[model samples]
Target chain A: MKISARNQLPGTVRATTMGAVMAEVTVDVDAGAIVAAITRGSAESLELKVGDKVTVLIKATEVMIAK
Target chain B: MKISARNQLPGTVRATTMGAVMAEVTVDVDAGAIVAAITRGSAESLELKVGDKVTVLIKATEVMIAK
Candidate 1:
């Protein structure tokens, strides 16, 4: 199977919530997920579209897998 | 547009981390993301595959949006 060595993965933005300093996106994946934190301004500056496809990149250190 | 009022979203489980009580899912989405905490045991029982598709249900109150 082809796998991306980089942490970057592409997904569509399903939803977004904005706070004073942190913004979160509800990314839609065909079969997987990753919870990530980003610059609060990104949520606004990027104008995260509901169906817009974007990339989700994360460092392993930031990711804490349960299983 | 179709939206889930229940706050349920689909994503692939990239990774899971087990803690004493809580498990965190690093869900993969195209553009957006949501961080969720679940039962630690669920991580093991669910057997979240790297490419497994799963649903993320979030209660808005639990979400703190940073903009």
Candidate 2:
């Protein structure tokens, strides 16, 4: 699908921790891991599991750079 | 600083490709490079350059997972 945001990181789902309202998903990239906190509904819809390959999409507006 | 959203990727700025209204910043993490397309104003304000250590923040609302 076409997305507006430019940053797309391909990684493997390392683990998933689900809560009542949110789910924390850890994706293992080449160098490190990226943790995504998404809503439980979204997580369920994605049906994410360990060893699954997913792309982490980040819009520029949501990104903050600190030097 | 404390951010409410969860996803944070640590990386070094490798290069910056700028346009009239937007600038694409490439960050080199351990695994690969993440390219962020941000407004020129925000890029200028951050004073981002090559070799800068920055954190790429992705709010849960802005992140999408695809299998």
What i-RMS does every model get?
A: 8.3, 2.2
CA lDDT, every prediction? 0.55, 0.80
lDDT (tens digit, per residue) of candidate 1 on A1-67: 4333234446677776677887667765444443445557666677765777776544332333322
Candidate 1 TM-score versus the reference: 0.42
lDDT of 1 by residue, B1-36 (tens): 443333455667877668898776777654455455
* Model 2 misplaced regions, further than 4 Å: B1-5, B17-22, B39-41
Per-residue C-alpha lDDT of model 2 across residues B12-66, encoded as one tens digit per residue: 9999988899888888877677777778888899999999999876666666677
What does candidate 2's lDDT look like per residue over A1-67, in tens digits? Answer: 5887667779899999999998888888776777877888988998999999999877665666655
lDDT of 2 at B63: 69
